[model samples]
Target: MTQPIRVLIVDDEPLARARLKELLSEESDMAVIGECRDGNEAIDAIGRQRPDLVLLDVQMPEPDGFGVLRAVSREYQPAVIFVTAHRDFAVQAFEANALDYLLKPFDQERFRLSLSRVRERRRTGATELDAELVERLESLSSRLTPASERYATRLVAKVGWRMRFLRVEDIDYLEAEGNYVCVHQGKQSFLTRETMNAVEEKLDPRDFVRIHRSLIVRLDRVEEVEPLAPGEMVLTLRDGTKLTSGRSYRARLQRALDLPS
Candidate 1:
């Protein structure tokens, strides 16, 4: 007889895990080998258990689902089916080339479809991570969390094994750093893997303005705006730090600040 497919379920919520377990139990060719409560535990389980498939939750404390993927050794990584509560992440999840992205409250039919895809991939012996999938997942790092229609009032960031929460009001400015965005608050800055555009979309436009391609400044933090040559301008924050506004962004900045030209 062929061996059953080994599967590991990872989710922070007990009910979520239980639900997945119940759904997966109906599959005769799949076996639940292990389960994890969070990203760190998932990483260890993935490395040690070496399951054939992983049902990973997108939102978790600190490391989260993406963090677990990043932490796992390439050789130990398995085919992933991302289970998210929000449909907003569907685009990014599929872009990462996951076997399937299941939105929360999915019925048994949907669950079976996801499992079927994994089974088909296994039969085809296509399980290796490719360059395009890696790049897409890397791009999805920051957008995974804060996937809601409501504006974000706080931000979640990972520092080592711990997760830090920063209120939107506490942020003084934001800077784009590669795949990450540096969240600048009083006397400190924390990095999150989300892109500037993603975070910007979550922020209230009335409270922040993008003065440069890489910069977003809190409106209340602006101390002065000095015009440079032609369309260029310099923005001085309350803390005395200066940021140059892109020539193309000058008019938008002016409109945001309501400055008469």
Candidate 2:
């Protein structure tokens, strides 16, 4: 019989680790070798245990999920299934790069789907990490500025055959357009194929705030905020443009503006 797939679970949350351990217990084809609570323990476990797969958390303390990959690339490259509670561009980055991930609070069906994908890849003899995988992870991790802890001050977008660089401060607001984001700056607008949450990760939270699920505006550009109704507000921009805040995002908008929550 084939050996059970050796797995390592790494997450800070006790409940998260327990849930994963519980789920893995039902899978006869997989075996739990160890569990880690932080990046340091994970790094050591990955090096010492040499598991076949690692369920990693992106929001862990220093040497985060990406850092763990970087540190292990030179020695071992285990199949990774990111188990993250992170609500940011990182999730989209992983998806866009074709990496498997299980967002937090995921249902059992979703969890099974992720495991199935990993199993399929292993069956196809494609379990090894390739150069492209490393590059993809690097592309997302490169945005992290440890010195400043901010992602980026400028964004590079594709415009037809040309590339455009838009500084974060120059942007008035961003709108979600299906699988893309339309960035408006004064009279010009540029479109990029990225999720709003992903784009939000590239911005400074103090400088920008999401007013709606579909909208993110520069805090300085907001001229006036008017209450429309319960859990709704209309914001007028400095350029006379008006946008309404989403009910779900009302509390966040209020907190961003230091209003009574």
Candidate 3:
């Protein structure tokens, strides 16, 4: 008789934790050891319970999911499956060699797939955290901003045969290209593989504003805001680029610019 895999669910939202619990309950070879609502509790639970696996959420208040991982003593480290709603962290999750990266609203099939990986690792007694994975997590954690607290200050992208790191402040504006975003800085534009909505999450709301469904601009770069048709406006950038604001986004633009709506 094999020992059932002990699991811990760490998420701030009760509904999210409950949903994970409900999914895990159906797994015959998995046992729910505990649930934590914040990073502090998660650290304590990981130290005390030593669960075989942890389904962790990336975004929480202060001392977020990454903070929990950082505080845990390496001796008690367990396999991790990062369950996040943001796709921006997927690359880091894979780089950290997480057991799996389960995006939010994932189906039962995806849940089962992650579970199966855990089972296989347990059966082979290969659940210990590797040095490379530990290094990657620490490195990436230092770069990730806790959800709703801060935003990314830089972006990493692959271009042709080389990689590029662009400073967020250097970017003048953003344009949505289907599922990709084109980050324009000066005369160069780099394509990043993320939706406009996802790209928006990585930018500081105070520094950036969305004027259109397909456009986001640095607030400080705006030269003028001109009224167009009813519920419409046009933004002129310092570089003489003109972009129209979406009717639905007009109110936000007005409020941001302190202009009459």
Q: TM-score of every model?
A: 0.62, 0.51, 0.51
Name the top TM-score candidate. Answer: 1
TM-score (C-alpha) between model 2 and the true structure: 0.51
Q: How close is candidate 3 to the true structure, as a TM-score?
A: 0.51
| Residue 21 displacement (Å), model 3 | 0.6
Clashes of each: 1, 1, 0
lDDT of each: 0.80, 0.78, 0.79
For model 1, how does the per-residue alpha-carbon lDDT over 7-101 read when each residue is reduced to its tens digit?
A: 99999999999999998899999999998997767876786789999999977764567666766676655888888887666665453333667
Q: Pick out the ten consecutive residues of candidate 3 with the lowest summed lDDT.
A: 89-98
lDDT for each residue of candidate 2 in 172-213, tens digit (9 for 90 to 100): 999999978999999999997667887886688888999888
What lDDT would candidate 3 get against the real structure? Answer: 0.79
lDDT of 3 by residue, 1-261 (tens): 978889999999999999999998998988999999976578768977999899998777534666566556756678888788866556664533336678888999988888877777776777465556546654565566444455667665559755577789999999998857899998899987667876686688888989899999999999998888877888999999888899999988877777764
Clashes of 2: 1
Error of 3 at 231 (Å): 62
